[model samples]
Target chain A: MEIMELTALELGREIKKKEVSVREAAQAFLTRIAQTDKVLNSFVTVEEEQVLQRADEVQSALDGGASLGPLAGVPAAVKDNICTEGIKTTCSSRILYNFIPPYSAQAVLQMQKQGAVILGKTNMDEFAMGSTTETSAFGPTKNPWNTEHVPGGSSGGSCVAVAACEAPYALGSDTGGSIRQPSSFCGVTGLKPTYGTVSRYGLIAYGSSLDQIGPIAKDISDCAAILEMIASYDPKDSTSVKRADCDFTAALTDDVKGMRIGIPTDYFGEGLEEEVKQAVLQVAEVLRQKGAVVEEFPLSLVDYAIPAYYVIASAEASSNLARFDGVKYGYRASAYDGLHGMYKKSRSEGFGEEVKRRIMLGSFVLSSGYYDAYYLKALRTKALIRRAFDAAFEKYDVILAPASPGTAPKLGQSLGDPLKMYLGDIYTISANLAGLPGVSVPCRVDQNGLPIGVQMLGNCFMEKKIIRAAYAFEQARGRWQAPPQAQRKFEKETVSASADDMQRKEKEMRSASAKDVWKTEVKTVSASAGKAVD
Target chain B: MANKISDETIEYVGILAKLELSDTEKEQAKSDIERMLDYIDKLNELDTSDVEPLSHVFPVNNVFREDVVTNGDERARLLENAPAAKDGAFQVPKTVE
Candidate 1:
């Protein structure tokens, strides 16, 4: 099997057994990314030299009889919003395009301490404001399942990176369903830990009260292991929780006997597509067969989640993002009248339309005359929503719902109608409001071949329950099959090229038009004599 | 109570946000905010009079630590990313005449 086909743990086990060198593993993924990322556009920055140097350092450590964690020697991608010391973390926005952090995020530091090799920074929606990654200044990431569709966002690039096998696993931040929605659209497993479970110290804030970083990988086991490595308390972020039970991997058992799973009837209503409903309901059916007591329950105030979420998140975002005036590290306008002019011009020129819109809305709601009616009302509504979840969790061990209302829409379908896009977040946003642990596992694919994810939410800090339920559901669902593009190996002549020649080819391919590259990729996949891996 | 968002409101909000929107963008923002307000008006239907507002999900508060500095001065490193810097300070446009 190819190195890219191995799960992160499997790759780590091979490296520990001396069967595969860390350098070889990193090279395989870097080469795969070089070959595929031109069409996917999943990465914002990939420093090959740094990746190789880190791989060698880890390899030497292992050789010297140093014991790294389970993910030691594994190459992982990081979402662009997460700060990496000395690496450009742009949040996929032009404002911070040249901004490199002087310090890394607490999660990135933990990943490094676990001996994971950093592949590069992945693209995301500008400041992580939009549902579809089309809001990114770098350009939207196309779905690996169908190149014509969006890969969901603002964690689109992170999800696409894992889906296309560009990286085995990646870290993505979830604020109002960024991680779960994209994971659903890309057919991968993503976990958004209960708020405060992961520290937000170095994560570029969009909505401070809601943002939590978690893992995106091919399966639940990888998600659990990655979560185990990154979840920790830090003094830097005041919201960080000190939890004694951070052993996420211990919940990977395929036993859901006597587990009470509640399917929210509100999630299955109205906007949910027929196929998506069936796919999600099918997960509950499978769980029921495995001795889980499944029943449909009303999760009230579902309709109010989107509005309350937008208001609260936007309010927090406006406050959090006020730090980006031209005075500091981000983009500065070339000419302006004074300090205020510079701030206005730099921000107006830097931020994308969606971000500016949210800022404006946030400002309007917080303005003196409207504060009581909009912002405070939203907060009160948020309290009620949390109460609703609290009431539901009293009887249910896990709440099963669709991650997204439907499968991945065509690339341009979502952005035109922003309200429609906001409504699509109905199923996932409630978890963010209540600070619940949620996991998105690929249940099945629609008729169009795009994947549908079944989201399972557990009460605050009950990550183990959702992980165990998701693991059991995944076992019943069988192994996940990669998209056709990800399964294809390059032709023999291209594969056998010298290192310099391959690099030159990769450069040429990147500079070529995306259409031409797509045609070349199609031809190469067709010409390959190798069979597709299951 | 979905009050119609006016052009004056959009312009004023733009000022509050420190964003300079062109006339066309203002028109767009007016319509978008109007629609959003219309949707948000649904919250008025629910009775939240007795509910306390939730500012954060976690109940933890007053997180305090020692006043001693954990990080040493890294002025040079921090200034490296500044758009303009001089004398170990970030330089901005003239604030006061």
Candidate 2:
């Protein structure tokens, strides 16, 4: 089998058995990324020289009889928001276009300690503010299932990297539904661990309390292996949970005999597409047949999840993102009369429209007079939602639902309609709001050939339960086969399409004046080019 | 429910956010914010009066550590990313002078 097609664990086992060298495995995937990622637009930065150098180090370690971590020799892609020493960590925003971190995030350090070779950083929404990667300052990531559809966001690129076999496993951070929603759209397995389970020290903060760094991989076992390596107690992150070492792989037994699964009927009402609802219900029946009890229950707080999530996320984002004002680091305005002018102009020029909109909404909600009506009210509602989850957990071990309301929306369809786009997050946001562990696993494909995912949400720190249930379901259903469109054997037309895109961007940059409302667009396109060339 | 956000409010919020919006953009923001606020107003239907506010989902409080240095300063490497820097400090437009 092709090295790129193996699961991370399989690749690691081969590397250890001397069937394949670490460097050879790295070369195969790096070659695959170069040939495929242009059409996918899944990566933001790919430093070939640095990647090979890291692979050599891993090889030397293995040759010297030194025992490496479980994922030794596995090549993984990191989302751009996570800092990597000397790597350009842009958060897919112009504000951090030239910003390179001096230190790596704890997650990256942990992965490296385990001898995992670094693939390039993947694309994301600007500061992780949008549900679709369309808000990316670089460009939108196309769904591998069908190039016309979006691979959900703000972790779209990371999900696509796994789906397209650009990388065996990749890391993505979730705030609302970023990881799970995109994983659903791209037909991959992504886990958003309980908020404090993984250290967030160098993850570019967007809704600090909600953001979590987790893995996106080809299957549930790969997800568990990656999680085991990264989940640790760290003093660097005050919010880091002080949990005992998790034996994630040990929890992967196919015996979910007496496990109770709750189906929130509200998740199936109104907005959910019929196909998605049916797919999740079928998974529940499969669980029932496997000796697990599945029942339908009403989660009344489902309707309030979206509003509360937005209010709280935006408010935290406004405060967390206030640091980028052209002073210590990041983008600066070329022309400004005074300090205040520089701050305003720099921010206005740096952030994209969606980011700016969220910041403004956040500022308004937290403004002196409206705090009681909006921000505080949302917090109270958040408490009630948590209470509801706590109450429901009293009767169930895990809750199952559609990871997304439907399959991947066509590219550009969710754009221009902010409300409609926000609704796409309704199914997954509650997991983040309640600080639960959630995983999205591909269950079946819709009639459109797009994959539908079943979400399994466990109570805080109960990732083992969800992983067990997902594994049992996965073992029964077999691995999801990638469609022809997903396999990225680069054809000549893809290169031409990429070139056409570049030219179109150059035209937009030229026609746009310094004062245009789309000034950020021009700046970002140009800055993104510099990123690619550098 | 009616839209509660106004043009004046959007303008004020934009100022607070340090974002400069054009007339057309302002019109768009007004409508978007109004619709968003109107939708979020659905929370009023839920009676949360008895529920305590949850600032964080996890039950964590005052994570403290010893007052010893755990990391060394990388001032030079950090300044490498700054748009403008003087001899040893970040340089910004003069506030007084």
Candidate 3:
């Protein structure tokens, strides 16, 4: 069997039947990461020793005739922002470059408890603040579909890891569109659970109210299985909800009969790329053909979502990030005269440009004079958006829209302009603001051979409805074909070797001056309101 | 549309955020902050007088657990992440005169 081509569930079954040992699966994935990650830059840290140790433990348990968990022996990756014990969780910023957590995130513990072997910590936007992965203090994670383009972020690395088949599945957080946007860009299935469904105990807070950790996998069923492992209430997180026992995998029926699917007309308005709109509309047709009730509806309060999201997310980020001063933990300034000076210099030097910009925007909005004008206004707008969603949910079982306005852009296309970058998130941000369960599944590929995703939004705790619908669509559409870039044979590259050589030389030069220039560039870019809240 | 934010405001905001900024960054921050503010000012078009502000999405509030420790002490492990540690606690620069 092609190890990289197997889904998590399929690999688990094979491991149980003794067709593949845990160690064999883990070793294959680790080797793949070593070979492909250099080009994709998906992982920030890969712990080979720890990974092998876990695999050994699983193999021993199996030898003792133990019934394995749903994800038994499946190799997985995690977003860097989710704390993993004994491993560095950098959030792709210099501040936490050496900050290793003493404990794993609650979601990660649950995954490990289910016999999942963590392959490594994947890279992400700095502090999960940017749209594309370009703002990472480490180099950007390239799109696996097209190496020249970006994988959408701030969960870009997680999406890339799974899409590149470096791991069977990976965990990602969606404060806004971090999981779904990248899943769409890289042509995979990702689900952003309802706001309070997944525990946030160890997820480094980007927007506390908006953040939820979810899964990215090759198919929706694999995502459902992973979600089952992690979705539980924890007393550690006050916002987490007590859920009834749910079998998300069972919800993967190929039936959408009698389902009421709402298509948001406002999502198809100006700025939505023509191809993405047609693809999503085509999804509506597919669902209708499956005996579901699909209709166009005006989702009110559409224009205010992006603005409200930025303001509220930035404000929360500013407050949450105040804990990062050099006095306690994380990076401390090497040269400083006093406590206050150290705080200033450390933050100035520690953070990347995008992170600082968000901190600035957050502080400005929550500052004394501007609090009511910006922050309070945003809160009210958030309330309105939530109310609008609630009203819509009363009518429709699920809402459908484009995951992103278009396919992934070139790496630096949105980096130079902040507003343009923010606009790419317009379709995905409202679900976060409303605290609704949202998912993205790859439906079609655009002319540029990039993936396009159709998003589904369901009411709180109604993930079953959306998952059932997406599964039906997936069944009808068939699984996405691996992009050409993903299937590229590593050894027989004849054309791009000189280009690769030039890139290697450039990388050497960049790494030489990266540290000094990183701090200065961070300061320079901190003034711009970079992408906010995941 | 051109440079709506003033430099003095950026300085005050930077101080509040505990970030040191150079003159060039201050200028960049001014333009960026102004552009963002201008974009966010779109909310001013609607009347939100009757709307209640929502700080959280869920209705649950005052979630209280038994006031007891649920986790073991891991002071050494926690301190391992500290940039500067001494005497089993995080050490910082002098605060007193």
Candidate 4:
């Protein structure tokens, strides 16, 4: 009866079995988004017309006896931070609020090619700063389970969209646990693939090295299907890996038979909520029963990740975000004739508070005197953190930890305290620092009925192993209960085929002079080491 | 100097970030930054002399692909986002003159 609550795999089966029409399934998501998005505030822009047209095309293909893809006809959403052509792909920042990218992000384009019916673009923290989605220029995406409670962000909307079943799957970019923290809080599944596994062509840079595009879905299987569609050797992205001979979905197996799963004592220690710890241990027990050799390993210095991540992420962010300076793209403030006026008015009017804070902090760290003391130190510590993970992984196939310390906290509580919200990334940051594959799978619901997640971290390019292990846990954890509020999301979905609104967005953005930033028209700045690989 | 970070430094950083800050922010950032710097200074005490500084965690090895000029999609939308443009190129205020 509730087709919206079904996983991508389940929906695919239903469509193939002729039990549900692809068009009907697309409509169910549209309807769900329309009804529930008001409360959840997950999606910033939904292309309803595009969803129906894409569904029709898929249906036509199915009728003509064409083989459907893994996630055929499944409705999915994109994070606003990711580039989507002709759409208002804001990084939830005012600078890019009215900006429509010339190209779609590599991940979005790939997912579309796989016949995944894109539902819409979801909200995020402005420029992917701040842990709570509250920093979004479009406003915070409320948790589907509780409107008053904060959805952990900057990918909070993506996580909430999946958790609330506005779409069965969504794409999110994680820099310092943007994807995983929200995934944990929203009680859904998300994976921050190995650093170079997914291309970053279209996703705007938050913290360049720290940023990775990942999948947020209801289950590990859904996450896997989306990953298969998105992951590949993208020549456009220099960091992309040549696709090794691997099938992530096919690698899903219940046998960890003799596989070593490590529970780092530091991960389970102080500040970890009892409910989340219990949930992680329960999942570990399931793995143990499946013949996994589980052990308590020592990574005692894990407490240092927050400060290191902040410094590194902010330091990089300072330079990366300097691109939207009212000259090239997006909104520029009026009443400014001079260059300095343009910079001041544009940035001050464009950026939200958290983004401003991060940019300022970043600029400070990277400034002349502070670079060695702050930025360089953070980079050095990042190496140490990577070594800790590498040492642990030499003994263990995968590392297990509670994704966030607890369920989604009450909204407005985490907003005031930036450092406290940052602590949620304590368990997730090291993986990004190490360039390892990490997956967050929901294990159980706490007494409060909010979901608790156990994250599995694997060695580089070992997404297959992590996906397999996460799938095994999903099977053990039993079926997830889609939130009730996300179910009524039976509303219309709207896609931009370049009508009046696109013209208006263009008109609003028409001011000052611009330049093509892609072709190296701007000034070439030096990297820290001076002319190494930029 | 006790290897100490100061209020003036935070204020200077805030200026670089283009943040118009108040008195409270200046003090708060000074304290917060000092706390972080102090924590990171613990690494200075570590004997990492023999260990080579690892810049990238993954073995990237300059993994570059052949550069091919792929046609960028959406001819009209490319200009849609420009604050100002003409003849398919973005127009900007004169500089480097």
Candidate 5:
């Protein structure tokens, strides 16, 4: 098998046995990224020299007889929202286009300490505000399975990187299905840990109360391993939790005997695509046959999740994003009359339409006349949603639902209708509302050939239950195959030109100080230039 | 529940958010906010009168730490990414002329 085909753990084992050098593994994935990422748009920044340098460092550490854990030599992608020291972490927005962090996120530090080779940041929705990655200041990431469709977001680039085999695993932050929905759309596995399980420090807060960083990978095992490496308690983030039961890999057993899996009947109702519903139900069947006790149950307050989620998340986002004025680190208006003018013009010019809408919505909900009606009511609804999940968990160990209403939608279908996009998050947002751990495992491919995911949500801090269930489901499902486009090898001559062009564009971007030049350059460099294979 | 968000409200909220919106964007924002508020009104259907507000899902209290210096000053490094910095501090436009 090719090095790109190996799971992260598999590659780590080969490196440990001296069969594969860390440099070789990193190079193989980097080469794959060079060839495939043009079409996928899976990456925002890919520093080839830095990646190789990290690989060499890991190789030296391995040669010196130091064990750095399972992810030692793995090349992992991080969503651009996460801070990386000396790297431009833009969160796929123009406001932070020129901003470089002085300190790395706690998760990035954890990965670095484990000797993992950082493969640069992946694109995401601008400040992680939208369901489709199309809202990014950078271009949207196309689904690997089909280029016309979106790889769901705000973790689209991370999911696309893994799905297209550009990277073996990636770190994706979830705030209301950002990780799980994209994982489903891209035919990958993603896990959003319970609130505070992973430190939120330097994650570029969108909705602080709901956002939790997690892992997206080729399968549940890789997700578990990646989660194990990055999950930690940091004093920097006040919400970071210290957990004694964080050994996620230990729950990889195939046994789900007598495990109670509750399928929410509400999730299978109207608006759910028939094929998607069947695919999720098939997961229930597979688990049932494997000795899991599967039954349908009513998960109350299902319809209220989206509105409450939007209200609360937007309120938090308004407060969190208030930091990005022209003064501190980020973009500044070239000309402004005064302090207030600078703030207004910089934010107005920097933020995209979707971001502006959310900010306005948040401002409205929290404004004087509307706070008690909209903001406080949403909080009360949030409490009731949590109580509903608490009650459901009393009877069932894990609740199973469809990750999205259906498979991946076409690239432009979601953005025009913001409410339609918001409703797409119905199935997955409740987990964030209740602070539950949720995992999305690809169940089956729809008639349109896009993959559908079965989401397993567990009560707070019960990551093991969902992971075990997902792992068991994966075992039953057998090995997943990458999309034909990703697996197809192009002739070297056809690939080199586009790859070189991309490399040159990246170089020019690094040298250029003007943000407008960078934006125009990105827009002009279309991936369609390398479409000779189809 | 206000089904219709007035143009005045949008303008006021724009000022609160520190966003300068053109007339086109203001109209767009007005309709969008109206639609979203209409949808958010769904939450009103479920009587949450007895339920307490849940700001954070987890029962985490305010974290406390001793007042001890963790690291030496890195003022230069901190100022590296500033759009306008001088004398080892962020420089903003004059608030009072």
Candidate 6:
């Protein structure tokens, strides 16, 4: 069997049976990564030697008659945004490009304790500002499915790694749609656990209020299994939630018989392309067919999500990112003689355009005169959105939506108008604003055969139900296809279709939408290169 | 959009942020701030009277644990990467200097 194709559960069983040494398992993945990483570029750094060493240590433990842990020998990748002790966690920004942290995140520590081998840090957008990995300062991560296309971001590298079968699973941070969008694009299961479900001690804050570190995996079970390990309260993270007293893994039984699924009319009404809407509704139909009662729900306040999220997240980010000045930590400007010069040089040289743009916007929103009007008012509107969700979830077990309006757009296509790019996250951002647990499960492929993900949203701390729904959907829909490049030349040719055709076809898909007024297509001509014109 | 932000307001913000902007940057900041402010102006259309303001999306409050220390004696590692330190504290140039 191809070692790369083994799920975490399979790998665990193999190691437990002693059919394969942990070192050998880690080595197999490292070798596979070395062979194909040139094409995938899924990893920003591959901690090869240390991984083998840790695997050997696990093997030594097992050989010495110690009880093997549940996730023994499972190798996983982490988004660089999540800090790992003594690793260069750049978040794909020049500011922290060489930052070696002294401590690992609590989630990473939990995974390590489960006997999961740490592979390496994966790439992301600088400060996780962009939906496409094209904003990465290091370079864009190519979709393993098609190298020319983008793997969704800011967790693009993590999703791409899982999609390409580089690792059994990867940890990704979602602020807005980072994890789910990338998962949707790459054809994997990704979850953004309820805001406080997982500890956020060492996650580099992109949007402090919204950022959540969760699992991106080949299937929902693996995603839930990983979350089960990582989700717990920690004294270190003020946002951590106490234990929910329910076993997430056990909660995933095929029991949607009495489940009330809410299909938000606003989610499918406008902006969603025909194929994505059809794919989402098809899943809704399947749920209905399976005896689950599905209803069309309403959230009048949900349309204000992007604007509310931008105001709140950007304001928080401005405050959080202020710590990156030259004096404290991160990249320092040694060329400057004075303190002011040092700070300016460091920031000007370090931040990307998007990062700078957010800071400026954030500063403006939180600034005097604007604070009460913009930031405070947006917060109030955010409550309205949350209240609506709170009311709907009272009648529904799960809310449904398309994770992204459509599959991954060509890189340069969405970048021309920033507002248009912001709308790509419209369907997913509200979940973050509501601090709800959400999962994006690949429902079906589009007309162009690129993947589309349908979102399953749940009330706060009900991650188990979200995962259960996603898992059941996966059991029905099937395991995601390994990115075509994972195979040989013939498969590569099949995946490597023309970008022009993909974009034009995506536009045509939008044109065919049942609702004519949404104007989903923004014919961005600049996506001619690797990704965003940015 | 007005496409105008007072130069005085820009200077005030720069001061608050401890930034010294170039004259050209001041012009750019003015326009960007105006556009962003204009965009944000749309929030007034929202009727939030019935809404209870949420400080956190998750219904978590006072997540504070016991104020007891749990083996947090890592001053050495904390100082290990400091750009400058002296006598178990971060060093800075004299404020009066």
Worst 10-residue lDDT window for candidate 6 chain A reads A514-523
Error of 5 at A506 (Å): 7.9
Which should have the higher DockQ, number 3 or number 4? 3
Residues A486-519 of candidate 4 have per-residue lDDT tens digits of 5444232232322343443344344322233312
User: What's the TM-score of each model vs. the native?
Assistant: 0.93, 0.94, 0.93, 0.88, 0.94, 0.88
Kindly indicate the candidate among 1 and 3 with the higher DockQ: 3
- Please report how far candidate 2 places residue A445 from its true position, in Å: 1.4
Question: For all candidates listed, what's the TM-score of chain B alone?
Answer: 0.89, 0.89, 0.88, 0.59, 0.91, 0.78
Encode model 1's per-residue lDDT on A125-183: one tens digit a residue: 89998888888877777788887789998899999999988898999999999999999
The number of the candidate with the highest DockQ is: 2
Candidate closer to the true structure by DockQ (higher is better), 5 or 6: 5
Task: Mark the regions of model 2 whose C-alpha exceeds 4 Å error after superposition.
Answer: A492-496, A503-534
- Candidate 3, superposed: residue stretches over 4 Å from native: A491-534, B1-3
Top-scoring candidate (TM-score): 2
Encode model 5's per-residue lDDT on B2-85: one tens digit a residue. 677677888899999999999999999999998998899998799988999998887778889999999989888888877766
How high is the DockQ of candidate 3? 0.54
Tens-digit lDDT track of model 3 for A279-376: 99999999999999999999988989999999999889988988888655667766665678878998998887778888899999999889999999
Q: Regarding TM-score, does 5 or 6 come out ahead?
A: 5
lDDT of 1 by residue, B1-97 (tens): 5558887788789888999888999989898888888998899888999998998887878888779987888999998877766578886654553
A132 Cα displacement, candidate 5 (Å):
1.7
Of 1 and 2, the candidate ranking higher by DockQ: 2
Report how far off residue A40 is in candidate 1 (Å).
0.4
- lDDT, candidate 6, A140-188, per-residue tens: 7778666667888889999988888788899999989899999999988
Measured against the true two-chain complex, the DockQ scores of the candidates, in the order shown, are 0.47, 0.58, 0.54, 0.36, 0.57, 0.25
